[model samples]
Target: MDFGILGTLEARAEGRRLSIGGRRAQLAMAALLLRPGRVVPVDQLMAVLWEDWPPASARTQVSIVMSGLRRTFRAAGSESEIIETRDAGYRLRSERVRIDTLTAERRVTEARRAMREGRTVEAARGLRAALALWRGPVLGGLDVPGFAAPIRRWEELRWRMAEELAEAELALGHHHEQIGDLTSLVAEAPYNERVRALLMTALARAGRQADALAVYRDGRRVLDEELGLEPGRALRELHAAILRDDPAVGGPDGPARPAPGIRPAQLPQAVASFTGRRAEMDALDSLPPDRDRGSDRHLAICAITGVAGVGKTGLALHWAHRAATQFPDGQLYADLRGSRGEAGGDGPASANVVLQRFLRALGVATADIPDDPEEQAAMYRSLLQGRRMLVVLDDADSAAQVRPLLPGSHACCVVVTSRAPLEELIAHAGARPLPLAPLSRDAASELLRRVAGDALASASPAEIDHLAEHCGRLPLALRTAAARLAARPRPAGDGLPAPRHEASVEALEACGCG
Candidate 1:
């Protein structure tokens, strides 16, 4: 038989739900389930069944309920009695019974172990799985006085697990994603300082400094108005940190330390013959503020999104090279391989692995890097503190994958290129969105002239326009088309042959342009 007390009290045997009994009988069964395989005295059961007072017939009523429970179990196909008869009371046999509360508790234990070990992703996943088993309040619809303590304990456990999950996600730089849940948690637990701190940190990280401070104020008011107490030391300190623009709000260990005179020029080579996007480049150039403090715009991060091969990386690199002199500390770049078919593996690149590589580039000793992604991220942010650097994340998969890679300093600017718009990063991380479309007609013609050269010299403007149209005005396609035109021989003054779709597509695919 499978029994569930995590939500409503329920039992199933032989693929059938067993109608154990009504109020009095359910109270008896709940008492037994609570102490499975243990003997409860007859007097104790009588007291639980009648919180007010027990009559002279209390013992007889208890016996009747026990008998009814045994008959119910037997009818459910149990060869032996589920409740054992003892001189004192009865013991619910646990040998063949499955209890959801026990299973959830075991899962919670495993999740806690994962959390202590700094395996945050695993911890979050495990915690979510454990919480999924809870259908509702433990023993819902059962108002027996005996269940009050156990119900409170289980509900508290659920909230504790939720708090741990929020911490893990925050460490992973999922501040944007955690804001909603954390807000709800804070509302539910008005006096829970930890939950309040978590919500405040998430707001701060997502570039909502004012809002973060407001949350602290609200918490303080709630405490003072309701309990006549001021905010705790931790909450007060967090408020001060947010006010001073301290980057250590949610970071682990402590404030990150700036790297020692390390200047890393990690940008990949700028695309040869790169053309167009002057307005886009200008917008990117203005991302970093002239002062140490950031402007109203979040944290000096810009997400450049476009269709594949639409020159997102080309525009980013071109601008990076031009603005290299602005960032004195250095430039750091990584290709997140947002698309699945790229190098490394079948899935998007791991943020931990990416952080490790970045740490090495920023002058961190290989052996000194922490094994935990959370610690590594903290170290990375700390190392970049107060430095004016430029970070380029190319072809990023998602915001979660990009959050850990963000430097803690406002002086440091990040430019992300991806096929996806990374809306979460834009909305939550305060990233300036610079979406790239296909090049303008004139820009496309100019690119073709620059790349195809003599191959397109005899080709008329209309023909060049046609060729650009055939390539969808995408830079990668235009480049490949230019290469094709440059290779093929044609008579002088002859317009370029209309490009065939199949041959051009095959060549583009063969070269892995996307």
Candidate 2:
């Protein structure tokens, strides 16, 4: 027979639940399950059944309950050897029964091992499986007097593990999807730092930087007003990173120092035909002053975002090239692959892995780079301190993925590009958002002329407008249409062109934009 005490005290024969008895009998089985394979002394049973006082007939009542429990076990199809009778009291035959508390504890151990090995998905699954065993509060209906402490401790363990499962989900880049659940978790556990931090991280990753900071504010107030303590270092640092519009840049491992004084010029060559975004560039030149907390609109780092092919990276590169002369410290850039699941052609680059490269770019020796992502961020931020450098984090995946790359202080500017807005930078790091919209028709036509050269010059303005229409007025699409027009041979003998679906514009665009 399988018995469960993590919730209601019940037994199952062949996986079907069975109610064994009322309060007195449940107390007997639970007492045995609590210390399976050992004898539960009769006096202790009397103490639990009758708190602070026991009647003269306590022994007789205990004997009757024990007899009833044996009958219930026998009726549940257990072998006659399930419970043993001893002169002192009784011993539960552990080998003959299954206990859910024991089962769940085993799963917890396995999950912990999986987590230690960085198998977070497996760990999360295991934790969820383990937590699923509890149907309700441990020993809900049959609360024995003097049994509160152990039950409370066990409940605490379940909650902690539940929070851990949420953290694992966050680590896997399910930032936007987990917001609702995480918000509920935080509400249920306001003082729980893990839940609060995870909630903030989820919000920040989902382009709700303001909400993320507000969560911290609320959590901080709760901690201060209730616990009389300040927010921990991790939460405070996260708050600070948001204020900088910088990627936090933490990873799985620790520190390393690469070759010293090695300023990396990692910026990609700017697009020669890059055009427009004049207003955005002007806005970048002027920024708002720092506000209270870490919310600074005039970002030391700026994030450029828009839909796919809207030219986020191209804009950042064009502006970076223009401002390159001012940054004597040097420029560094990485295609973070934040949006389309890949920064380049490859898969998304985790923050820890990218921080390793950034550390090397700053001239620190490889041996000195920390294996931990946070340590690398600290060193990277230190090297960029007071240096007029430009860091381009392109195609980022999430805010946590970028936080380590952000410098803690000033004198360096970073330009980040993504298909979707990264609101964390704007909310906390004083990042200026330069959202790129579709180019105007005039701009689109100009871009096409510049890209296709004389091939497009022969076409009438009406034809060009048709082509632009087919190109969706997006720079990437327009360039593609221009390239296609350039490749096709002009009508032989100059026959009048027949109207078509503009087959050259297949909605196919380049692998990247800005």
Candidate 3:
């Protein structure tokens, strides 16, 4: 039996071909393809099917779809097990299948690494090969909410990879060849400043300096007229460098220096003030120490997991920031993209990738790190065996997604933030979970004081209470409201507009809350 997901859905067995009919089956197939070999939880599948509001028969409908997909696979003359039902949900066995999406991703990652290492020619070849695997959008005929997030993410990655490939080609002195493709891309995505910058560089490299300057001017005009924002710093600098005929701008040697550090930009925009969770934070800090000195029995692994935008991350970060001094070695932060539509975008970071990054942060050289993921993870654990490092794994998708990255010794503490409560992490890894609740009335008022400043201090106690109640007592919503109030002009003679409790009430009511 042969399973091919690189293009259209095709499973071949013996001498016959199987037909998968209906849009639902196709969508089911697409979802399975996204994860390939992992079990997509039943609840998550239901959410995908109904998107925040599953009908009473949603579970039954999902089972029916799975059964239909199985029959379709069998009818295609394949005795292969395409889908397997588990205790939680279902898994698609893709061991022998040729999945184009996986292939494309693999190629693109390889090309990106090669390009980073100055192997432009190899990068271009690998990227071109990867691009060739994409015939069209994945499961084009299917329109399911479950598929939309992953599909959109995949499409965006595809375009990013394509842009990288074009840049690689230009670096390889194929500027003449890249002109047409870059032109088309620029037309299609005029607001993509990165693409425009690349086009200008390509034009300049191909001896069209005047055209390159025109490209920059045109891009700047478009941005100012349509978006009313200046070009990004990088684009503006590139334009200036081109105008001055700076050799370093389009030279084969690339930029003269690397950026200062590899750290992700600090969370610049302030999150809404945290409300409630003080007891939860205290409980997290009070977890029992490990008993075994030679083994990891004492230090607790505390996991904060909940639904998206439910303040799991907010609570974890707030607590971690406050408790930074406890873990004197360092405070490590990673956005694992565990839950989509929650924090970061889709496509959670792999455990190996996270481990590699963490190890590097701990002063391990890139070359010193082992190539095998298992070895890398082991090395990471070994490094953290006796250290008191505070590691925050934010937005984790699953237990398996984070298992390998765990610190071996109990001396170190790990705070994980996830959308789903990882019961197994608690049972198996001795992880303590701190469930977060919405803010209390007093806590909400204090948060408003922090955000609204003196203006909130003068507001009537009754109005403040009404405002907090209206904001659903959720920290994020309350902060937004407070910020709104702070931005408004101060009232005359110490008098303010009447508190619009009904407006806040209506907002919460729309969200199905009090």
Instruction: Give the Cα lDDT of each candidate.
Output: 0.82, 0.74, 0.72
Return the TM-score for candidate 1, rounded to 2 decimals.
Answer: 0.50
Residue 79, model 3: Cα distance from true site in angstroms: 36
Name the regions of candidate 2 deviating beyond 4 angstroms. 249-514
Candidate 3, 381-430: lDDT as tens digits: 88776777777888888888879878876877788888778888888887
Clashing pairs in 3: 6-100, 18-76, 289-298, 290-297, 290-298, 290-299
Tell me the TM-score of each prediction against the true structure: 0.50, 0.49, 0.49
Better of 2 and 3 by TM-score: 2
How much is the lDDT of residue 380 in candidate 3?
81
Per TM-score, the best of the predicted structures is 1
C-alpha-based local distance difference test score of model 3:
0.72
Q: Which stretches of candidate 1 lie over 4 Å from their true place?
A: 250-514
Which residue pairs in candidate 1 collide?
256-382
